[model samples]
Target chain A: MTEKLNVFAVRTLTQKEYFAPGHRACQGCAEALAVRLVAKALGRNVIIASATGCMEVVSSPIPFTAWRVPWFHVAFENAAAVASGIESGLKVLMRKGRLPRKKIVTIALAGDGGTADIGLQALSGALERGHDFIYICTDNEAYMNTGIQRSSSTPFGASTTTSPAGKVKMGQITWKKNMPAIAAAHNIPYVATACPSYPIDLVEKVKKAASIEGPAYLHILSVCPTGWRSAPELSIKLGRLAVETGIFPLYEVEHGKYHLSIDFPRLRPIKEYIRLQGRFRHLTEEMIGQIEERVRKEYAELKEKAAKGVAR
Target chain B: MGKRVGMEVSIAAAEAVKQANVDVISAYPITPQTHVVEHLSELVANGELDAEFFCVESEHSALSVCVGSEATGARSFTCTSSQGLALMSEITYIASALRLPIVMIIANRALSAPISIWNDHSDVMSIRDCGWIQFFAENGQDVYDHVFIAYRLAEDRNVLLPAIINMDGFTLSHVIEPIEFIEQEKIDRFLPPYQPVHRLHPDRPVSMGGIALPPIFTETKKAHEVALQGSMPKILETWKAFGDMTGRYYQPVETYKAEDAETIMVIMGSFGETASAAVDLMREEGRSVGLAKIRLWRPFPFEAFKQATLHAKQLVVIDRAISIGGPGGPVASEVKAALYGEPIRPVVYNFVAGLGGRDVSPSDFIKMVDKAEIEIEEGNREGYEIYGVRE
Candidate 1:
């Protein structure tokens, strides 16, 4: 399978100049990487509606612009809604013979704060409408854009501003919100979870999403070195470890079937995952054991769902 | 296209959108604005109009879909009222800033709390500064006509903006009136299909809605404002073209029976006829009163307001919505602001009346006209009276 996949990769051509390399993304910023991959997959015919957060502030700082493709950054909460309006606006303009060029795609980009918190209603409504668009949530676990504050997407045993580690507590009390699962319940054409270390896989998933007829969601786990207090170079190693340790599983939902995209034969222990990240530095052996137990149980459930896919 | 004669207001609005030739319409049923989108959806479904209609999840998506459609450089149209319009509040600002040329119909209705679904100007007035060109219609005919004109104004090269055509909710949205429709071919001649200067297309790429820095951000906003103020000439020109094509004239401020009247009643939206009837009735009773209907609320016709109120001694400004804690009603306050230092202006009296579509009877109009005169005589012109408020 590996030999067949990368064998013809030389012939693969990408769409040109949408989100260019000049963007002000920090090194090892998973969110920016996801954006870069998505842009390549979407081609030059794409337009983006991004919420105001880390990526937007850094990339678009005034007279400077990073996008070769058309990009619109509305408020933090209404990126989805703004993307919806853009989608509708383009359709109408095309119908009236006003559109200069034929091919155009609109997408909304948001951070965990923008998507899981204030923007959830707009996100949910946009998906429910079945609009022909994609919404990508660059989940950095916490609201790193706003100073490492806690967000709903923040996972268990993680130390954030609002979920700081203390004498009586471990780290965060709650587990990460099942955003992809919730989106899956919408019964949209497509829903997937991805991380940036695997660029080609991310691109493939995005291509699959774009081919779908209606709303498709892609939740990307963006690593935040500043927020997670992890080493910059450790980002990829940490991202890979997350999947290997079963902390964050990569999966996709189609029609009604769930399929695991990245599988680990023998999962690594949870202690190895947390010891490198400063956010979970305070975790003890017992806490790691508990996290491991929860991860194993969740992985088992996901495996069962993947097993049920053929019947569906 | 030829002129259509004597049709329902809602039907006329649907006809205008059909004439506007929108490509995608996102709609959900809301009272007063329902028929407009309902009819547009039918046209799209039946191939009467070649279009895509998205029966959206909610008003939020309705506006979102409109934004997406506009950003893609497509001519999109939608109609919503009250709660629906309120729900779309966030996107309304984005639509204008993106300069998508989105045309929307806001059937004026009172927002709920008391939960009434009646005709009123409250909803439209609440979003007064939403960055879209706001227009008011006195009856169904205006709703039908202005929608076509709105598309022309919004899609203009200079004024690439969004516009809202507000007709009185139940009163104008549901009321069938003699509305003259223009032929589609005629509309095509008068208002050409939207020609966007900047399209979000791959061939000749451009960036839209970028984060404008301090150096350029102010200029971006200034561009919108300058376009808004400068759009007056084109707005008048569009109206002239429409009038020339259909023989039905329209103006920002329309005056009637005010040539030599002592008292003038200023109002907006669907209640113009109600004010007109009182003007006629009061004149017979020797009250020397007339009426002035303001059609364009934004890019407000200051010259027209100045001309229409030039001869009046007392002006009764009736507003259907209240602007609590700041001024009386926003319309009354705005009127006062417009006439702040005009040398020969009449003494203005603001009246909050006909809220949430409670009846604005001709009897009440006459009483308001009389009350304005009494307030003028008493030298009391600073405050407002909630008209028909019960003890």
Candidate 2:
């Protein structure tokens, strides 16, 4: 079950910022805001093992850091593996009486490129081993840090630097990799999808994930304004449009049971979401129709799963 | 003193890790390196070693886990052979730079294009510049003893760097040998609980492995180089204290009957023992030949190495790994570089031998020396020959 939060409830939330300000993030980077919300949920009693990506580079420069909690950044593609190690190390140390037995939540943060592509193996390994940690994948569709290169999580019709729109070819021709489905398939204790546009919901989901035992995966749809070639001011509006258009749904899967965070009797048109971003500027009406068809089918399937409820 | 027991060297290496009281052992199984992790898992399973041992997905994740755990102020360890080492080599450099002080045991094996799971120096040679404190073990006993010494040296506040103990695959790992382990009390005294210089704790809240810009990159590297080179004194001090407790002394460059010899052979890893025997055999025949075994490979004992072989006229450097089109062999290149400016230095000759688990016995070492001598007489000085290769 998910709690309904109003603007009044958001005002009551803690004003303390664990992810400090004065770091090098873009003007309207929703991923950075998502990180701040996640950090707020985790508070000071957490250790983060971050993969080399946008947030890692933006937050941690030598001798400077945005993290108020203990954080570690290893090479690309091993955030889950590193988090597994941190969890096991802390567990063993506490058990051996070398450290005080306190609840220290271990979290692994990675971008979509780090999570869906290079880091997939390490993530699967850590999930299979069932380490007590939270894995948060901030999905911005492409490798935005490397100048908008195409990633596996890049949507089928979105144009990137690597998947350039040209005379003979169009944008990314592959469907976005369903990372939440993969995480839920691991039979993990909790798997949720959130967005920074819904700040309270994102924070609540992260808090729930941190409270659960064993492994939890959170896939947050992080909107990149610079990479998407959209106006920086429309970053939150774009995220909301993505969810309302059913291109990126907000839901949670707990123990094989799915719960849709927001239900719509009628979904918004794909043009309202796609026309605002430069990445989809090259798409024709026919291509937009095709994308809309697929989005409708996928959204219907997700709704079916949520209705099935306790089927698993 | 503890009881001397005949055990498989890999198992003994695991026992040494157990005695060191490591907090985490994360490894992936590879040939010749499997038994070490297998025994460690067994120790953890049976409640003999109170450690967290995980068989991770790959060697990359294995070393990544060690780096994470070590950064968390836990004594972490992992072992791998050639392919596994190559897979994890990227993280090895990071671990040392972060100064995690994780101890690793590399079972030396040949790299694969032909894909052979056999003993050679190719694995360790590939990571020559990884910046870890690297050394070779001459035999099973040496491998067993260095585990404690590595932990002591790596965990020292003055020498907070990771270390690698290389032992010949199958030659030292699979064979049973008598190892005399130190008493538990002595080991505890020698290697105290690891006190990390920086750790990821909520109480401390430090950031590790941050990206260094160009302005600060060179300074960080300079500091790392200084830290590695500065660890030599602590390494010597640790060995001296261990020798006082166990009565078996160790050194950077160990020599065998090289004090008055004109011709000396140089080698590393398990071949040192066989080369020593070959030197003795040659000496009995009234020939002037000796052996200089290089124990320390990184922060390479330049002074001790020059002291050992500068007097000899001809130095036969036997390398187990080929450099492939660049130089003759990696070790021979280092030897040449170490002796380049010396006024009294040997005319170094190199031979690549014992490749892909091929047997190079005492006679084989003697034959290599004989070949080097004849080639020197024939004025063939610059190039190296892959010994035992068919035309």
Q: What overall lDDT goes with each candidate model? A: 0.81, 0.93
Candidate 2: where are CA atoms >4 Å away?
A: A1-8, A310-312
lDDT at residue A117 of model 2 (Cα atoms):
100
Worst 10 residues of 1 chain B by lDDT: B200-209
Worst 10 residues of 1 chain A by lDDT: A1-10
Q: What is the lDDT of residue A208 in candidate 1?
A: 78
Across B1-391, the per-residue lDDT of candidate 2 in tens digits comes to 7899999999999999999999999999999899999999999999999999999999999999999898888899999999999999999999999888999999999999899999999999999999999989999999999999999999999989999999999999999999997889988988888878778999989888888989999999999999999999998998899899999999999999999989999999999888988998999999999999999998899999999999998999999999999779898999999999988778889999999999999999999889899888899876598999877
Clash count for each candidate, listed in order shown:
34, 0
What RMSD does model 1 have?
3.0
**For candidate 1, what is the DockQ-based docking class?**
medium
Query: What lDDT tens digits, residue by residue, belong to model 1 across residues A122-159?
Result: 88878887768889999999888779998999889899
How many clashes would you count in candidate 1? Answer: 34
